[model samples]
Target: MPPKSAHHALQLEHERERDATQGFEPKGTFGFIRYLEHGFPSSLVRWHYHDEYELHLTLESSGKVFVGDYIGQFAPGHLVLTGPRVPHNWVSIDTPEEGVELRDMVIQFAHAPLETLAGVIPEVKSILPLLHRALHGIEFFNISAQAHERFMRIRDSTGLPRFIEFLTLLGELARSSDYQLLSTIPMQSTDDDAALARISSAINFIVQNYASQFSMKELAQQLDMPERMFSRFFRSATGNSFTDFVNRLRVNKACELLMETERYVTNICYDAGFNNVANFNRRFLELKGMTPKAFRQQAQGRFGA
Candidate 1:
């Protein structure tokens, strides 16, 4: 047997109550609601996805957002609408957000169950382009700028009215031509519980501790598998060595820091898990398409950060 097929225990339907409530209504007018007051650590939740769609209106803080092969950084005032099963997490726990205090309202729609919204709302006609583009992961340009004026109003309203206001925004999202897909390959999800369990555990460990020094032996031992075999499986599944994945993660974090802060290059190099300045500069340039300084200057100039 091929390791005796495994399965995923996490069913999004169970968690639908929390995401559907609080303006992210699922299943119509009467549904449960869940509100959260979490921050960076909360962003480290994991790499799992459910059937519900997630919409985030982030007001403060900056971090790298991941969805399958798409890797991009985000800043305050970002409005992101993601389809189901897009495994994502933002990595930025050290920096404190300024202005507006890093508040974000994440609404999850059990639209998976309703699955017929597009058929019902013909206003969503214009959204087909956006939805098709979203197969890769759609990002609205200057989400903060394009949607800010209305967001201020949405922030103040609550209850059913809030739901309507949110729906209007969704219509805008559907019609938005100012969007881009971060990548093309949809993230992998096997119905096997065993495979998902191991992958999730590995992803969680890497996300939380990638900045620190650790070894595959240490990690494999923790996972209760032989080191070599574990490394083989991990690389095969993710398309890269474990170390390479961690390094890519580190580089992604460095990009976010470069785009969002005034921190010095050397300080950022160390902070992003590189012990040598030369290596940091080289790797950052190799992966980000520009030297660290150039990248920062360009991002800052564009955002006026």
Candidate 2:
């Protein structure tokens, strides 16, 4: 029989599937960037996307952050800027001992608003480059400390004070050169419609079949391309080899199961699409910087379990 963790993971998977089908629409009443401060393990903790630029600051805890096709680790004070319509989520690796009350400070604004404003406001144009770079997602590795302060001020202030602080933060980020683009390939534009469709189809297939063993040859066949040609295109589009991309997805699934279920590590290993425990452990450690057992222990500690 399948392990209990398998059933639990399946249920969570269904929830995420539903979320994706229904879509998440951010509601902003002020016609500007909306500010939100929320704790961990909330409904907002899911894989979803919206048509707005997102500036996210992790206030506490560490986890793996998924933005576009990029997968990486994140800790408290981690800051990221995601472009419009980019799919993203941050999964905390471990819960806090005292319980986390606030895990993220977020601000969401539309691209049109910023672009329109930039046309009339000469100073606003200075930050346009930063926004452009966000098409692939941007990680401000060294600006977390400074960014956190600005995020806090934006969170605590009201009215014009908050608005001004947000603009100031953007200006600061624009001037900073310590940021890195998270995604290997930038989102395709109108001119690359054909390429966009091809890559999108490939991504969808991967997301749907990540838990099963498959070959690049089979994927190429499905896309009606020769294996070598498809491989080159895939690598160019995702900035990752086919094997690396699959492993990253599997590792990410393992992480979610580790935190959300009480199943054995061995069960999680297979359920997450790894053929064996040893390989799963190796990959998990490489990506997460810890063993599966250690991750679970840390997560359990946060919940006082």
Candidate 3:
């Protein structure tokens, strides 16, 4: 498994509701794609996931990048494409006294429209392989400048021109070999929509409440599912047992604190929902391959702190 999965459930729920009520894609939009940009420390900067494939470009600042179970550093021009419902966030560690003006530029689009197009458009089908690979998130290298330029074109245009630029960019990315898959365990879901919805709800709950104690029994009850059945369903959907998933989320939380704060290891352990220092140390090492203190020391070097 990758180190951890991260999300903010309340914010994710809010985004879902907002999109449902107000709509994210424009009424007159020709394609499913939407372009968005936000600065550091903004409301958009949260650990959350949505039902769109996102091409994320870091325009300013460097810090921790969380994609599904993967945790690592990101600087300017760092580009990643994440699939639908993959929890992700980027926290800036080296912000100035005055925060950055524009920290991230993103393009989000749905999978269905493109898949539908590919039925008749042979060339459009080439990107499907790349889309499949993005189920685990892809970090692209050596093409940041081209990505930035193409993103600008896609953002500034509308209708067919924008769609053309979007395909052009995806084609470039699809053809490029300089990329790495971030998540070790791919997030594959069963065809049952109800089961997927339940899993999504459960994941949101875990993201919001990972700092506190919770039980699979309670969650299963809330979802009106049998404990054993839910256990099988969850592991099938997320590639980890319920308890293991939550623990990894907590470990990822610990990683964030270690990289971004000066709190003591014991305090961070508890803050990350670990009950005791010894267990925290062990789990941290098991997932991150380092003790908490050592992790913090190395993370600090990222900021020269």
Q: What residue pairs clash in candidate 2, if any at all?
A: none
Which of candidates 2 and 3 reaches a greater lDDT?
3
Q: What are the Cα lDDT values of the candidates?
A: 0.62, 0.76, 0.81
Give the per-residue lDDT of model 2 (tens digit) for 86-114: 66788887996565788888877788877
When 1 and 3 are scored with lDDT, the better candidate is 3
Q: Give the backbone clash total of model 3.
A: 0
Error of 1 at 198 (Å): 1.9
Q: Quote the positional error of residue 228 for candidate 1 in Å.
A: 5.4
Q: What is the TM-score of each candidate against the true structure?
A: 0.64, 0.61, 0.66
| Predicted structure 2: lDDT | 0.76
Ranking by TM-score: 3, 1, 2
Worst 10 residues of 2 by lDDT: 6-15
Superposed by TM-score, candidate 2 places the C-alpha of residue 137 at a distance from the truth, in angstroms, of 0.7
| Per-residue lDDT of candidate 3, residues 1-305 (tens digit) | 11123334313423444341232344355356787777777767776677789999999999988787676789999999999877688989999988988888888889999999999999999999999989899999999999999989988889888999999999999999999998767664444556656776787677668888778998898888899999998888778889888878899888888887888888999999989889888888898798888888887887798
- Tell me the spans in candidate 2 whose CA falls farther than 4 Å from its real position: 1-29, 96-99, 188-213, 217-244, 247-305
Q: Give a tens-digit lDDT track for model 1, residues 236-296.
A: 5565688777777788788778876779999998888888899888888777788999988
